[model samples]
Target chain A: MRNITLSKAVNEALAEEMRLDSTVILMGEDVAEAGTPFKVTSGLVEEFGTTRVIDTPISEPGFTGLAVGAAMTGLRPVVDIMFGDFLFLIMDQLCNQAAKTHYMSGGKLTVPMVVRTNMGATRRSAAQHSQSLHALVAHIPGIKVAMPSSAYEAKGLMKTAIRDNNPVIIFEDKLMYQDKAPVPEQEYLIPFGAAHILREGSDITLVATSSMVQVAQAAALHLAEQGVSAEVIDPRTIAPLDEETILTSVKKTSRAIVIDEGHQSYGVTAEIAARIAEKAFYHLDAPVQRLGAMDVPIPFSPALEDLTVPTPDDVVARALMAMRGELFHAL
Target chain B: MAKPAQKNSDAYLHMYRQMVKIRVFEDSANELYLTAKMPGLTHMYSGQEAVAVGICEALETRDKITSTHRGHGHCVAKGANFKQMFCELLGKDEGYCHGKGGSMHIADQANGNLGANAIVGGSAGIATGAALTAKTLGTGDVAVCFFGDGALGQGLLYECMNMAALWDLPVIYACENNLYGEYTHVSEMAAGALMDRASAFGIEGHEVDGQDVLAVNELSQQLVARARNGEGPFFMLLNTYRYHGHHVGDINRAYYRSKEEETFWKETRDPITNFGDWLVTEKLASFDELQALHAEIKTEAKAAVNYALSAAYPAVEDVTEHVFAETV
Candidate 1:
């Protein structure tokens, strides 16, 4: 196993897949030469050439819709949406067209496409660029959504997503791009809908997604010093969520806190928290807690933005609240 | 090559029959709605039959097409049968999409039809993407994107057109300028010249009489060949008129258009009637044969409608089935 940066992992995944199959093509604005603003796709155009590594114009809907059509045909197009916020521009093409084409065509058509994007805050990019908008896509029925927390998860999940038959959108936390994690040199794949257990404990269950997985792990680490055992579960794929794993973990702990970067209300945290509240209601603990980004446009001010997203301290405090049987949450 | 040199009488008769088939399909679909038989409204392709038949006749079975909401003409022209189309319209089991995709979303992939999108100008990207697929896979196939005058208002058309031109993709952007975009006139919606939109991207542009099947067919053959030969990504505007309103339920359309204009198109510029007259004049088909052909199609349409009306819907247990494909 080699400790590689998440950006390198993603680039490796794309390179490996492109080397394996000629039909796998990459297209996005600046993806070919500039390697995207995030630089996750650097060296791809060199390896695969322009025919496979395409640089599309900055038309989100245009390129996304094109990816959908290409997927329906023979090509496996991996579209790079530079930011997650731009997903709104291609809603009609992505949600209405890509998501429904297979079902609408009564199983006759398949859109084997992948949209690799980034989701997170703290880059001081402000509202439009920093928002974690995976919930908007996960709400749709047909498309699959995956959020990778580390380099290993990023590479494996990406390879799996590229091979999936349906339309799959993957959100990689932009903040974690340079972060190093152990990734194997030999090819590996992380299947969708499987939750990865980062830490094992019985005191409380911390169900987190994407970047929140690291936050939960930090909180777990701090809590372990305080003689409290916290289990960190990262739901790799949110759409086909591993309910069995989450529910089983929550059942053992009796207390749960779902953390995510999206807004708290009607968001990923709310959905997971509500599920724990509904299914494990009889497990006798404090109410299912949720720690998500504040319900406001992500602020550009460093001081103000620091208060919006849930940090490790937030998870520690929330876990303490559940531990103390405190039925109330604080702002 | 003496008597008008148009001796392909079989092809002429087939084109005539296809036009009649579209007319009959819409006429029967309108009756189905009026009699409260069909569940939802339908957009009629009555006056613009020639554009679809003209462009599609030039394409081989390997060629792909993306259609619009007003798509029955394209569907039939691309060789979709009446029974399955009626089944799709009536929401029955035997429909092209197994009744999931009704009139607005019918996709006959077997006939190289990508789909008919409900969103205005939605299929532009999909069509261009298909061209990209053909290029990348070296499939030697061309894709035709069919959108109405209304779609000119959408940015996606220009975006895809720009990409198609840049990539030199084998695609034909066929704009059926029926003069209206859902109760509004084309002049109110589109700015500047339509052909200039193509020239802005350096893509070749052409215009044809949409009601003249021969004219539309002649241009379509040349464009399709050029596209296949890598001299492609052409845009053609077929000037036509809509015989019906925005939809079948849009009966009171005097607010936007006139009865005289409608009558003028139906009487003098009807694609099927004019084509039939030309066929008889050129000795391609006799007058009686054209009449018999129309009657035969009408009878076939009647039978298909009856079959679709009696066909069962998908089973209740199958409601949640196929939300996603099981495999690639």
Candidate 2:
């Protein structure tokens, strides 16, 4: 295993896939010459040439729709949306066209494409630039949603998403791009719907996604010092959710705290919490607690932005509440 | 005034048969919808028969075309089976989309039809992308984007046009300028000349009489040849009108257009009548032969309706199937 940053891992995955398959092409605004603002595709153009690594004009719906058509016809296009917040601009293409083509065509067509974008707040990019909207796409039926927690997960999940026969949206946390993890030098793949248990414990279960996995792990470590054994589970993909892993973990602990960076109301946290409440109700010692971003839009100010999303401390506090049987009363 | 050349007689006959087939099929569909035999909405392609036939005639079986809401004409012109298309409109198990997509989303990939997009300007990018695929794969295939005048106002069209021109992709942007964007006239929505929009993107653009099938077919041949030869994208604005309303429910269109205007186009410049008249005048086919062909198409359309009506509905347990590719 070799240590690499999450951004490098994503770049490596694109490079590897492009090398393996000549049909694979990359397109986005500033993805070629500039490698995107985040530099996720910095050296792709040099390696694959401009034809394969394209820099499109700033039209989200246009290029996104173009990618959908390309996928349907012949090419496997990996579209890099500069920001996840811009998904709203291409919802018609992504949700309506790309997501519906396979079913709409009666199993006659398949869009083997990947739309890679970054999600999360706290970069001071403000409301439009900083937002975790994975839940919006996870709600879509035809498309698959992947959220990788570490460099290893990022590389493995991206490779898997590219090979998959349907449209897959990979939401990378911009804040975690610089974070490093041990990724294997050889090829590997992490299948969708399989949740990874980051830390093992029996007292309580903490379910997190994307950057929230780090927060959950930090909280678990803090809980361990205080004689609380907390289990941290990261569901790499939200759409094909690892229900069995989550339910089994919840059954063992009998208490669960769902963590996500998206809005608390009608978001990923609520969806997972509702599932646990319905399927694992009798196994639970207390109601599933959810800690997500505040209902308001992510503010521009550092202090306000920090307050909006769930912090490690917030996860620890929620875990403590669940352990002490005080979460219901505290609410 | 002049006879069609003996060499091109067969091609003209084929084009005429396809156009008549589309008209008869659409007329049958209207009857089914009015009589409550078919469920859901339909955007019929009644008057714009020549546009679909003209452009599709220039394409080979391997070439791809993306269509719009009023798309049955395109499907038929691209060689789709009338029986299967009828089955899809009726929402039967034997339909192209297994009865799930209904009218707005009918697609037949085998015939090189990408899809019929319900959203305005939705297929522009898809068609352009198919061109990109063709160019990348070294395939001689060309992609045709069939949109209406309404789609001209959509930003996605401009975006794709600019890219197709920039990349020199093998695509033909065939705009069926039916003179209206649903309820609003194209004059109110589009700014400057429609062809000028293509020139701004550095692509060659042309305007043709949509009612003249031969004129459209002549231009489509040039454009398709240019695209196949790696000469870049070509944009053509086919000036046409829809004899029917925007949809079947839009039977009464006095609110947006005039009866005189509709009558003038239908009476003087109806695409099918003009082409049929040309066929008779040119001695390519006698008047009796043309009438016989129409009868034959009508019978075929009627048989399709019967087939669709008798076809089974998809099973209840299979409702959620095909949501994703089975392999995925």
Candidate 3:
């Protein structure tokens, strides 16, 4: 019955987990008293004290590597990388050490840790700060990747990631931090690999992830006004993807379009679209389409930046093409 | 300053045995490579046995340690036997990591050895984090990070040391200055004085003759005890050497290092021979007794190699197993 912001949902999930388990620690730059640049971890240090909600230096690799070791021990660390662009700085610790520790150790050691980061474009933060790089991490085998679509998804997913036995990476769209959505007061968890079919239709499926879920939803509404019905689905976590849900929906609809904010080249859209084409080849009327961020460094200018990521109009136009069967060209 | 403890012949004999085990293990591993039986090459820990055995002897079975690519010595010193280690080196299922990880990534968690990192100075954070866990959980446990002079080139080590100093975590950053960073001499690799790296962060620094087991052990014991008391995050510089070429296949070394330098360290400053002579002079072990112990260790190492060579390889279906701790 109550609505909360996505950032607050993340903070609440961390606070609840920290209260439930003493070993759950929060470590990051400006995470303690400053509460992070987005204030997502605000009031955590006040309640859990400095030891639990740690304030680390500007050492990305340093603290990330430390989190790997701490997780192998008794502690469950939730490490915050302020921006997803900095994930490159911690590839060795995150991909090499944390991701592979469980397998490398033959299951003798487990790194039950969460790397919380924000990714999205159109912030006008330029190439250095704004980039949705979740597809890169999802390529790695050992890590689980989560993309929360709303405040409700954020709270449930954050709790699940903290308790996971292997390394997990949760990507939140920085632009959606303050976006409010209805969430339950009681404790709940959203299991990974489960797809949420937001709205059902028979003609076509508009499957998307993270912030793009809202785009698919808006496009579905616009398509309805234009006498076209579209189904909307969100694969909450990309790593343990609910392939069955997406495939079953595509099989019923006979047409699909996968949308994500990651780069279009070798990106999340390509992977999802390829999977649909491979599995649903017999059922498809027109080829499955992909709408993702353009394959270029995110620009700084607002006008230029807005052109990179896909929009609802882009989805609607693609849907109209599928309905008209124009997507099938000479190729 | 660490005060040397009153001597007991039993302690000397135990350390002597550990050092011999490492040496014999390395020698056998080298033979495994020469015969083309092992799958991949290995970084030998032969000459630096004292540095590992000395520090590990000062630790309890519960204390944790993060080792380097050159890690067999640390593994053996931290209570790992010959069979699992040889199996791991040979990439067999009975190995410590079930054959998934070879020499460069052997991790024996049951013995509190977290794992050996292939990256230089990579385990600094892991060791420090273990110390953080000990402090947070009140476990009274300490962590040792064993790296070589090459690790001095990594900035992560400095970051971990700075944080360790800030938190007063019980961790010892032990740098075995074996005078070479892979192939480059330490003089060319390191920028300034090595001990200054610790003092810049206000961490207590200590140096020891790594060839002498008692001296290195005495200091490690003092540091480990002090760390347990919450006065740690110390730094140790163990003046040591690596006898083999960087790896087993690196035999030609006329360009980087001369044969004389290698022979000098082997003959004059060999840790095992020096310690065995000290034990004989102190009347703790007879010369005949030391020779018999050496022979016994050699036989044990050879037997382990044979077992590992005969061990089964993991099934191909199991390749996907353990990628995740559990399916979620």
Per-residue CA lDDT of model 1 for B105-181, tens digit only, reads 99999999998999999999999999999998989899999999999999999999999999999999999999999
Candidate 2 or 3, higher DockQ?
A: 2
Candidate 3 is scored at a TM of 0.98
Clashing pairs in 1: none
Worst 10 residues of 1 chain B by lDDT: B1-10
Query: Which tens-of-lDDT digit does each residue in B86-173 have in candidate 3?
Result: 8888888999999988898899888899999888888988999999999989999999999999999999999999999999999999
lDDT of 2 by residue, B1-328 (tens): 1222233789999999999999999999999999999998798898899999989998999999999999999999999998889999998989988988888888999999988999999999999999999999999999999999999889999999989999999999999989888889999999898889999999999999988888888888888998899997999989899988999999778989999999999999899899998888878899999999999999999998999999999898778888888544
| TM-score for each candidate, following the candidate numbering | 0.98, 0.98, 0.98
| Model 3 per-residue lDDT at B248 | 88
lDDT of 1 by residue, A84-187 (tens): 99999999988999999998888888899999998999999999999999999999989999999999999999999988999999999999999999998898
Order by lDDT, highest first: 3, 1, 2
Over the stretch A90-148, how does candidate 3's per-residue lDDT look in tens digits?
Answer: 99899889989888887799999999999999988999899999999999989999999
What local lDDT does model 1 show for residue B228? 93
Q: Candidate 2 iRMS, in Å?
A: 0.9
- The Cα RMSD in angstroms, rounded to one decimal, for candidate 2 relative to the true structure is 1.3
- What DockQ does predicted model 2 obtain? 0.84
